[model samples]
Target chain A: MSWVNWILVICMYPFVLIMYFCLKNEGHDPKKRVYYGVSLSKEQAEDQIVTEIGNAYKKQMKRLLWISFLTSVPVLILPSFSIAFTYWCFWFLFVCFVFFWPFGIANKKLREVKLEKGWTTGEAQPRYTEIKEAAGIRKVKWYHFLGPVVISIACVVWAVLQPRDGREAMLIILAATFGGMTLMFAALAFWMDKEKTAIVSSDSNVNVNYARARKNMWKNFWVAFAWFNTLYTVGILFYQVQESEVTGMFWLLLGLYILFTVILLVWVIQKSKALEERYADKMDLKVEEGDDAHWLWGMLYCNPKDKHTMVNKRVGLGTTINLATPVGKGVAVFLILTLLSMPVLGIWLILDDFTPIQLKVEENCLVAKHVTEKYRVPFEDVREAQLLTKLPNIGRNYGTSMDNVKKGNYRLRDESISCEVLLNPENGLFIRLETEDEIYLFSGFDDTETRQVYEAMIK
Target chain B: MVIILQDGSEVPVFKQIRNQIVMGISDGRLQPGEKLPTVRALAEEIGINSMTVNKAYQLLKQEGYIMTDRRNGVRVRESFRMTPELPLESKEQLKQLVSEARVRGVSQEEFMALVEEYFSAGQRE
Candidate 1:
């Protein structure tokens, strides 16, 4: 396995736990009016059957969490990074499916019991908003996005003006990273401002204050995100330019960044939940007319009657698209397609890693090939071909870097560029073939095969 | 200004909007010259069709309850034209109401008492 595999595996186990807790947090909220994604009255929520269902769902998720942990054990021993990476992808999806499956089941059961006991919250959509609150300027203004946008733009410009070498690809990625995150935050701010401020009670003051507080919290979050990304960009770029792994500094900064990000996310989520509790603490469903029926699986919001495309999520921190409108349907289709493509991408990566690298001598020329990557250098242009047991700090500029395969353009720390079509770096053998245009690093499937190919080329 | 919409109510969405706004005015919750949300904004806020809110606004404008213009958007009328007689619509409603009260065994004295209490429901100065 490679460093990428190790990083992903480390990140994933904690993620499973995080997802579990997020679902657990969704249990009972006056703002949401649901238990396990099922709407119920205060009396029904306390019913023996309802309590039993909630516990059962929890137990099932715990079992799935343990199972997910166990399955990852096999991934550690997987032969290559490709296998491990593929297993991790599918395993993550499996954990997600199994985790949500119990919630969906519990939701279904609770809904059934609600119907049988006549304890429905009520059949209400986004059907109410006070007049004054509707017109209240309780939104984060557009200028709230200005700070982040300006910082990210400066970062992108800085990246662009950096000296152009063969590292153009690397710089472009840096620019894209900063620019993309800025755009995302800006869009999020805009989308959120456009959403209707929910009327939690008859009091417009409470509603207005609640809306303003939430908007301010998110505004702070986006601003913090900008600072975080800026620091990361500066740190990474400094290291790249120096052509040295300030490994200790890089790791420390990365660790702190991740820590801060997690804390910020958790803070926002808790603050939002608290804000709901503070404002609508006395909110109680008086009739069977609840919003549970409008949500699918207690997660997705779908109300055909709601003209707005974006609606507040029933469970999580962010908003979800309504599945009733044309835009909502389009978003749903896109998400479904994306979910379906995960496994396909995993399979494709595995195939790419397993594809053998071939070095052939033909017609006074040498060709090193792996998958779709082919590098041919005429004997006349080939200045040198040297076999080595180790490579330099060959960082990828724009290429594939799987455990078994490394192909396409790469660069030495602080150096220009090289084209590599190498397989099985674990074999501890490689060939440095230099041509007029660029350097080529290559190898065969094994030491013996590579040595044979090198001898033939020399002859 | 809180209005709980009954989607299953027989009242059309536009009528519900109009009724609520009119009630708000009479209840003094809506002040004269107070700006109202645009047709699109109110419709989106209430999660209904924009045209529904437009129709309500058009009705309100025609009845001189509200006004609309390019610069002002929509707002409650500063003052309404005072007439000595009740509108035909109110007359019809009053006719139905009195007939119901008579059938329900309400004496003239009791009916007039109720009328006095409601007529003086001027909670706002």
Candidate 2:
């Protein structure tokens, strides 16, 4: 690499660090406290504390950004010297170190906030809500993944196609790909933040924003950093092994680097485990007192008459409809398809040929001929129905299914039906009517109840 | 009776619910026979945890201020009554208020005369 290229890379380090801290510290803000029809003034002790923490976080972020910009100035000038490469690399590493410094400080401040005020204190309460708000609309708004996916593909193709002098190019391409992947991973983290239930436990004493952002940033950084380092190390190894002219000193340096990286990774993993254990120990699981009737309160589409409706505790679906388990079935389908294609594709690649897997609907069933001998009932046969009792492992143990049914666990009255059928140990057909349209075929039912239910449903 | 829960108020939500219910009962705005909203309804209305509303109701029941029947749901206790006796300090404060009024150029005769006039007018209406 030219001196200018090295300088440019060094110059970008502080900016990257600043960006990291900015993203990490983004969620720390005091939420406006509300009590009995009145807005509590920030003058209140708890509110004041929250304000101070938020202000401190903001100030720290500002300072970190300023320092990053200042550090970047030296790299822009492109220092002309014999040790320019070393100087540029060291400066780049320093910038990366500084980028995470604010996050470390913020983490400490969060610990302080947790200690000084009780974990469930007002200042700590609002952090999660604030972070959720800051995360913006839930879906992955940033098209970060596309760039990484493209770059990764390009790097792989280039490495395969190019015969000689491609090692250095591959290393640079792989590094850029890693960077792009980091951005994509960060976007995914934000997306997960949106989808996951914002359950800020009442007993959590620390500011949620401080805790959540810290946890998320640390998680994202280390995961990305580790993966990047691993890939870079592999790339370097590949280059050294492939090239005939690599020096003995380079091999020595690579060995030491690998050893140091492994040690650091181990330490991080141990620290993370300890932190998780500590949190688990401190967390209290309290059963909040309330009638089950109150559970439906403030819920969307909840009517007084809908009190008896049996809702899925897992999927949050009401008894009246079968909502697609969000992202579950789709992901399952993708995985199944991928698994089936892998062997075929691998073999085809060796033969330098390909054949597309065909899906066919036979007798109202989706049959996969080229893959597993599995078939799915057509959509028309699928009924949206609720079980009379909570399916085993579905409902709260404290509540009896019979009592709920007696109290009126209204099930969906859909026309379409699907049954899950299975064979028993005695070779009897054990058919489970899953929906109105489809029957799942399986084996090992304890009794004849499964056959009886299936017979009743089909009849 | 409408009860407003201030989300930003320093008081906890349950306490707010309890205090409002108490105030409503004492002021006779909530009648003895009247049914209060279910815990779920109340919580939904106030945008608070239903458990908090349940807590308030539980407290009210323990205080003999409300009754809950599974069939009829929650209602004000039929025999619920606030103690009529004024505290000694309050009685003393009343005496002080009368004395202050007397000092401020109002006599007992004038106060009685005004009271009689109001009563006579009410009777005529």
Candidate 3:
């Protein structure tokens, strides 16, 4: 019902739609001559069983698409963000597992059909690369890095110039962060330009042209991302300089940035597919290099024999690591753990937001509590305590900021920093307690309760 | 121009690279003074070790089949003479091949004719 809830729904819809469409078109794409990431000859791919299996997979994907999209509708009317946040986190893990379930099923079925029909592409086929295609002629020029490098340096300069208020420092660091991000894109673009492209066609010219087209597309994507970083960095700097309200502006910038990134990614994927199809279309659908044994369920690539750490993914748009390598295994474990911990993250968010802030006098100490994070100051140590009608213009720096609960380390607009805070801002009352070494702000569930705590603390 | 490498081949990767370039030259697909990819570039392209490619390039350079400089990277030789006398290694290998062909009922004249057919392309170029 709230604006924030609406934002959540809007954000989720596009993601699911894109995932659905991409997976829908994936595996059995005639252009790539791949059926469920399995390399099959034209005759084998066109078999009756293949069609029946592919259609069955399509039907299941359509059902999943509806389920994914329809589930998002319920979040629009969710009373609180905690429940919605929890749902979204779980939903992410669900989609990650469920969407791929269909792929895995389809891959297994197609691979079975491939074997049963005596259509096995050889396990150890040679990797063919044309010399002219490998020639590093169309390299990323040195000048292409100039703008992003300059921006990164400028960010550091801006950070150095800014006043060292905690929030102001964060804003300055953000400029540099954007600089780092932009530079990363520049580097990635450069590296990708140099990386070898997949050989799709027997014709060297066609293969060479396809590689060039794909490289150009990736280069454009990185360039776009670099510019995006600069633009968003400017917006953040503007907010910091103007000392403007963040609620609406933060959401607007963040939403637009996410939406822009998604659109760019989708365009890159679709364009790359088109280019491959255009060139590879001319080639006879002869089985090229096939490593069906290394690809687990046609999704996970686990080839130790591969010298390269990263390999072109058989099923998807991007590259995946060779999981048999040490670094690859570490990354895999980290990713799996991160996905598995989403429910725990949702729980943590709930506890941070829903737990009531307790402000009470115990043994002459002004004790503030929220879950395990607590701050206690002796009344004798409190140098000054002021009861303010309104909270300061502040933003979260390191802790939780919920709609009702604000329990965090925060920074004010005046370049000042609050060390500890546990307040419910809707009560419209706060106790700004200052000590020799620390600044603490506390408020209770209601204004009356906060007033009592303030009266007791000042006594 | 398409350099294909079998993953499970008994030949070392560097040998595979070296042999392919030699065959390409023999077939005239790769011409005299034609630019080859840099060691790093070729290694990355083929998903092999740079050291492996370097060894191949080193062998090619030692045999006067290719040349390398900082500016030009690596390239086929501007012109290299095809000597009539084969190296001891090649002669040994040729003897083995001839014996195999003789055992397989491919007469010496038939094998010589096959050899002539392969050499004729480069000779014409």
Candidate 2 lDDT, A38-129, residue by residue in tens: 12233432555545755665676677667666655544454332233334445545554554454445444544544465543343121111
How large is the interface RMSD of candidate 2? Answer: 14.0
Candidate ranking (lDDT, best to worst): 3, 1, 2
Candidates 2 and 3 compared: the better one by DockQ is 3
Q: Across residues A13-63, which tens digit of lDDT does each residue of candidate 3 receive?
A: 777877877777765666557777787767777888888888888899989
Q: TM-score of chain A, model 3?
A: 0.88
DockQ of each: 0.46, 0.02, 0.53
Which 10 successive residues of model 3 chain B have the least lDDT summed?
Answer: B116-125
The per-residue C-alpha lDDT of model 2 at residue A387 equals: 22
Chain B vs. true chain B: TM-score per candidate: 0.87, 0.63, 0.91
Choose the strongest candidate by lDDT.
Answer: 3
RMSD of 1: 4.2
Off by over 4 Å in 2: A1-27, A32-66, A72-82, A97-459, B1-125
Ranking 1 against 3 by TM-score, winner:
3
**Model 3 misplaced stretches (Cα beyond 4 Å):** A121-123, A133-138, A281-287, A315-318, A324-345, A386-398, A409-420, A436-439, B58-64, B67-73, B78-80, B83-125
